[model samples]
Target: MAGPIVSRVSRVSGANGSSAAPIFVDVDTGVDDAMALAYLLASDDARIVGIASTAGNVPVDQVCANNLGLLALCGADVPVSRGSDRPLAAPLRTAEDTHGPEGLGYARLPSRDGTLTDYDAATAWVKAARDHPGELIGLVTGPLTNLALAMRIEPALPRLLRRLVVMGGAFDYRGNTTPVAEWNISVDPESGSEVFTVWSAAWGLDRPTHLPIVLGLNLTENIAMTPTILSRLAAAAGSATTPMSVLDDRGSRSAASNPLIRVLEDAMRFYFEFHFDQGEGYLAHLHDPLAAAVALDPDLVRYEQATIDVELTGTLTRGMTVADWRGHWGRQPNAHIGVGVDPEVFFDRFIARVGPYAATLG
Candidate 1:
């Protein structure tokens, strides 16, 4: 079968009437990560400049493969760079149980055809930011290892980029990993701490000026991929017909056969089972996709300024995100944490944008 079909749409400017946002994505490339990539690729409002892979949902090697495959499926020309293989201070752990053995359920993407960039992830990050100073938006959907390493290499990385959006952490809610810690932050609390604290000092600006926008589980968990939405998406992809079933200029397999939709359906079987086991109504939270949405359109969710930090040393609560919603923490706020979302709006837009792309694939 062909990999997936992708069709180009007329480009649309963002809310500010500016051109498509230039974004650099750091991912672990799990199922939701694949969805996030699809959303970004299908949207005319996002221009993915680069992808940095890290260890979270799977090993860094697998993450790299997943990213490369997704890019090929979408016919995107973005660069993919390898990042940290493990956490900065914690032992490496992954969510294979949730994402399946390949980290994408049953979907086995083709092997990467080209060589990775000469620069490592840290260097790639610095170069991308330096090249597009004040124009790049960094979106991280995995552990913060790559971002932390980039910060170490370029002390001004955070300041160089226009904004940072993270899809991790759990504020005042039960965590998916440990009792208190979310998967991404728990995977590397030390790196998370570094990311939340480095930007302001790197920029030498007031805390509010460079605060990272954190999309924690508290907000993302609300944007679930319910059966209704999935069914609608599958119906759209299955029913739609398109030409161009052959390879394209990028040598990517044509998606006109709806291969991408079939792959997503296969992948979501495992995801749905996992969520069903968790009593979540066979719904997988669209965590990373929602974060991607917020990166391009900030108005999808409401945010609050807070002093956020990851717990490094709590016997039972290690890796928990300490979001100081109250003014108890004397320190200035360094993060704008997402506290709420409009699920109806999010799902409506998500299905509308992502479903058609799947349909166009062969």
Candidate 2:
């Protein structure tokens, strides 16, 4: 259901400065995505105006369900809409085993049949940009399918958006889904290509200012989900399990002891168990949240300008993010590439931001 539009900037800028922009999030609800949503809701620097779900960590249907469930858990009022069923080019591939059957680490959600905006997801995205013209920040935490659709439907998308921040591709690190291509781009390289070509050409903004796709594996993998963070998450799991409890359990309980811990315990234990079985132990990569973090704070990452294009035809290299970082091709760089992150400080800030949200998960 829609919540009162209490001035997007005021709601997000709570205690931080009052210059935060309104955010439009497109997601595929994995556990990390759930955490990101909670973090954004908690932050004073972001106002999540809307959410569009796509096919990625799980099927489109399940992702939508997860999105609504997570928003409801936060007691948020943002609109949730269904997006593209498949990528703009290739067939859709979902990470069922990784996200579990429900795409939320099998976190049980309530029967919250909330109403969404009447507009289609693509139309809603363009409208959000148009209504606020150059004031909206597009935060894409999943594949670029819905965004490609928006560009196709609204030919003036370049003029509508202030900035488009995406989570995909790879420059130096090994890919999570393949050796060369990251999971989001590999799912639909054509969409990634379309976004890069259209936004870069249509905006006429400075070379590195038009469209920025935050490469996942390269910048985020190092921001591991450490045990200390998991323990903090475990302590905060009560927020995800209140529907099962009566009023006796409502408000002002000792946070150190949470009922939601049972679910977090199961999810994290399962997550670590699977990774450990593969010999990686408790360490799991930070794939999507770090991308959202870039949108929230660009300084967390060190960027280098580059010309980027996706390989759509190569049997072996298809879906790879072919970046021209050294200007060998003699063309203007289309986008900025994120090459490095302050590992210690990045994780430290991430832990500080997400620790409270993880506590809410229980």
Model 1 C-alpha lDDT per residue in residues 17-62, reported as the tens digit of each score: 5678889999998999998898898787788989999999999999
TM-score list, all predictions: 0.88, 0.83
Q: CA lDDT of each candidate?
A: 0.79, 0.68
**In model 1, where do residues sit more than 4 Å from their true spots?**
1-18, 204-209, 238-257
Residue 346 of model 2 has an lDDT of: 61
After superposition on all CA atoms, what RMSD does each candidate show versus the true structure? 9.2, 8.7
Ten-residue stretch with the least lDDT total in model 1: 1-10
lDDT of 2 at 169: 89
Worst 10 residues of 2 by lDDT: 3-12
Predicted candidate 1, C-alpha RMSD:
9.2
Report the C-alpha lDDT of model 2 over 193-299, residue by residue, as the tens digit.
99888877775555345546455577776777655665645434433332221222212222234433443333444454445556665556666677677667666
The regions of model 2 sitting more than 4 angstroms off are 1-17, 205-207, 233-266, 356-362
